[model samples]
Target: MLMLTLLGWLGGYLITTQLIFPPPPPPGDLFEVPDIRGGGLASARERLTGAGLVLGEIDSLLHPSVPEALIIGQSPLPGQVLRPESQVRVTVSLGPQLRSVPDVSGLAEDRAQIVLESSGFLVSVDTARADLPRGRVLEVFPRPDAILPLPARIRMVVSTGPALVAMPLVLGLDREEALILLDSVGLIVSEITEVFRFGRDQGVVVEQEPASDIELERGAKVRLKVGMSGRATEQ
Candidate 1:
């Protein structure tokens, strides 16, 4: 009778333990998703596998701050309960979008600035003395057709026409000295007239067409009359 009672008690204990209080599921069957954003693609894949999850479809897009091939986004956000071997979709970065600098040379300054700004570039203008018309774009830094990341700063050189300067006094000076003085002031001597004069005035500049203190564009031509002991000659 005691043996029968012992056997019945053991049977009841087994049923309660097996049915009433079932054991927890195996650790491998569930997982809490891990955060893999900002990690490299290869490393993210390894991380997902280690967490009992698998990498799913990968999409890529141009991201300004995120580096190329790095994970920028993921589905099944971190700390979510997921079944083992569940797939996690990710979006990878292709880095900042590259842009080709457009040809803005010869365009007006305002137009060039608009074009650059429209193309996702920052614009800065610098005035320079050029042969082109005033306010025209002479050139651009990084040159045309150069490729760079978006939002890059571009420096444009715009024409203010030719530079102007006051003509220097060359009268009564030696011809060579007069030439040097004119050159120093950004003036070019285009014509020279040789005139017969007294011995004291020989080899000296007697007159200049534009006179002194006249404002003229840089590289503007000036006519000079020089004294000579020989017969007067035109050159």
Candidate 2:
């Protein structure tokens, strides 16, 4: 009886499995992954999804030289076999990894750009803080001297050094003193103009060209306003 019961149990188990389970479908069913490894993010996303896939969460990682938003790598690697709806696990190239921002001040704009590019960075200029002579680098973001990383985006203030600079204040100073100061600096004495505003004496400098205390390159010319009130003859 024990032997018969054991045989019956084994037969039932076999019958249930065959009836409950079926063979898996054939492997030809899957979505094709488009080759977008080095394309722009938006374009890649559009292309990938258009082809029947979705963009996975972006993972930020350090790269040494690749541009940002560029696909460093892709999931489901191009031509790899994956299920149609199977979420492909991809490891994209995070483009040249971001390095610490370098300090690029005091360097010429062109030179700075070259340096930054060599060190894996892209550079841009801020015209507002620039001087004349566009190629000269007037100021660099992140200070003058600091360590920076690759694939860095740097905005610099380039010098159009020829741009006008504000003149420095020299009011209340004697003509000789003013002339000396102006000459010492990059300023020239554009003839001194005499004015009689507010009835204050003549031949005295009333105003200055380029205004007071303005920054300018050496040799800037200033037109001085001198008081020209001639004195009446005292009898």
Top candidate by TM-score: 1
lDDT of each: 0.90, 0.66
Any residue pairs clashing in model 1, and if so which? none
Instruction: Name the runs in model 1 displaced over 4 angstroms.
Output: 1-30, 166-235
TM-score of 1: 0.59
TM-score of 2: 0.34
- Model 1 Cα displacement at 111 (Å)? 0.8
All-Cα superposition RMSD per candidate? 10.7, 13.5
Number of the top lDDT candidate:
1
lDDT of candidate 2 at residue 195, scale 0 to 100: 62
The list of candidate 2 runs beyond 4 A from truth reads 1-96, 128-135, 142-150, 162-216, 219-235
